[model samples]
Target: MSEIEQLLRPELRGRTPYGAPQLDVDVRLNTNESSYPVPDAVVRAVSAELADELSGLNRYPDREFTALRTALADYLATQAGVSFDPEQLWAGNGSNEVLQHLVQAFGGPERTALGFTPAYSMHPIITETLGTRWVDGQRDAQTFDLTVESAVEQAGEVDPNLVFLCSPNNPTGSALPFEVIEAMLDAAPRALVVVDEAYAEFARPGTPTALSLLADHPRLVVTRTMSKAFTLAGGRLGYLAAAPGIIDALRLVRLPYHLSTPTQTVARIALEHADLLLETVEAIKAQRDRIVAELTALGLAPVPSDANFVLFGGLADAPATWQALLDDGVLVRDVGIAHHLRVTAGTPQETSRFLAAMSRLVPAHMMTKENP
Candidate 1:
């Protein structure tokens, strides 16, 4: 092995960093980022907040980040229809960081974490990198469904110290049924259950959030980010709602003053004008539904989605279809699934471009019974 490889942590050596291809393209949908930009009014407010903080950059940001946490609690109360105290909340650079803080506190060399496969890729990365053993759980092979029976069985079998669950799960683009979450908690009695709700704002109507279950479930954690529906991906703000005790545990692992002044200011201002900032949500959801309907009409199988992206299958060759779309100036994610690619919902015009590109490639790249 090379010197640096040898010096790397035994678990980390030969690992690929978690990221999507950040290629410049006309219709980029590889990452599940909001296709809309932040509103000008919110931008101006953020600018004003930052200008006021510049003179105080000499001082470290609030170690507690009290103001930001209060703002986040206010937003969640309105968004999720559930109330939370600021003390019951914790935040970090992104949801990923909050997740890391969780693993660091609960998962270690001899401890284990369990996550269903085809969920967020970062769950495994964070768990393993923190010196915890990772157990690969499963979803249905055909439909990607995690039924409560299956989830309960896996959790009981693993008896892990930590469990990762993704609602509006990544790459699959579907929300987990609340029954599965409750069953998991019951089965893994000793495990801390984390529900990554990064796309919570985009879930379809009638979809219930895990946040509602926190009143009685001390082991439950529900994390959300401003990167998606809030249209503040660059702002790097993510927070979670859990029992006060769980929030206290996260503080033990978080680096002191880890959130900077600017990050706090940007997120808080955006939260203050949350209604205006969230105007594009309906538009994005419209586009997401359109993509699913159109793909299904084209003979591709799209998993029913509650998130802002759609995972479609029936590709004869996923990588080749990915390049074909990129060549047409529309980039989607080839998530390493055998015949599926995940595409983020963008603006109406961008959606048209992606669907048109798919139309051109389908006859050649799609898998049909005769073709197969």
Candidate 2:
């Protein structure tokens, strides 16, 4: 092995960094990023805020990010009907960084982190990178659903120190039944259970958020980000709500001034204009539903989604279809499932382009029992 390779941590020796393909194409829906651009009003506001903060760049940013935390707490209160003190909120560059913080603080050598399979890919990466043993928990192979019994059984078996759960789970695009979160808390009493709600704003109406459960369960952490429904992916602000003590633990591991002044300024301004920024949510939901309807009509199995993306199965070869879609100036995610690919819900026009690309591949690429 090369000297650098020999010197690297054994756990990371062969591991690739997490990323989805970022191919340039007409309809780019590989990542679940919002297709809408930031509103002009919000853009102008952020620019103004940045102008005011420019003179202060010479000094270090607020070590605690107090104003940004307050804004996040206010946004959570108004959005989820749950009140949190600023002390109960913590943030990082993205949800990924916040997740790493959790692993760093609560996970380490000899501890274990458990996450259901085919959920967020970052869970295992973050766990293992922190010298924590990663337990690959299972979901239903066919339905991709996790039941309370299954989750509890796995938690009991592994007794993990950290548990990662994703609501409106990535690639599958379905929300967990609230009971699953509660059962995980009970089963893994010693574990810090993180519920990633990155796509919470896109969930179908009546879907419950774990934020409400936080008042009673101190171990439960509900993480959200401005990257999704807020349409601020470039802003790189993600946060979590938990007990004040749990939030305190994260502070111990986070780097000093981890959130810069500009990040704080942009996020606070965006939170102030939350309503205007979220105006396209309904339109995106409409497109999501449209993708489901159209894909189902074409005999593909699109998982019923509560998020901005849809995971559709019954493709003969997911990677091949991914390439075909890209060739046609459209792009979707081949989430490495054997017969499934995922597509983010974009504008009506973008959705139409993607659907049209799928239509062209139907008889040749789509799977049927007879063909199989």
**Cα-based lDDT for every prediction:** 0.91, 0.92
TM-score of every model versus the real structure: 0.99, 0.99
Clashing pairs in 2: none
Superposition error at 358 for model 1 (Å): 0.4
Candidate 2, 320-356: lDDT as tens digits: 9988989999888888889899999999999999998
Q: Roughly what TM-score does model 2 have, to 2 decimal places?
A: 0.99
Across 1-372, the per-residue lDDT of candidate 1 in tens digits comes to 999999899889889998889998999998888888888888898888788889999999999999999998898889888999999989999888989999999899899999999999999998898899999999999999999999998988899899999998997989999899888889999999999999888999999999999998999999989999999888888888999888888888999899999998998899999999889999999999999999999989998888999999999999999999999999999999998999999999999999999998877888977765
Residue 13 in candidate 2, Cα distance off native in Å: 1.1
- Measured by C-alpha RMSD in angstroms, how accurate is candidate 1? 0.8
Worst 10 residues of 2 by lDDT: 363-372
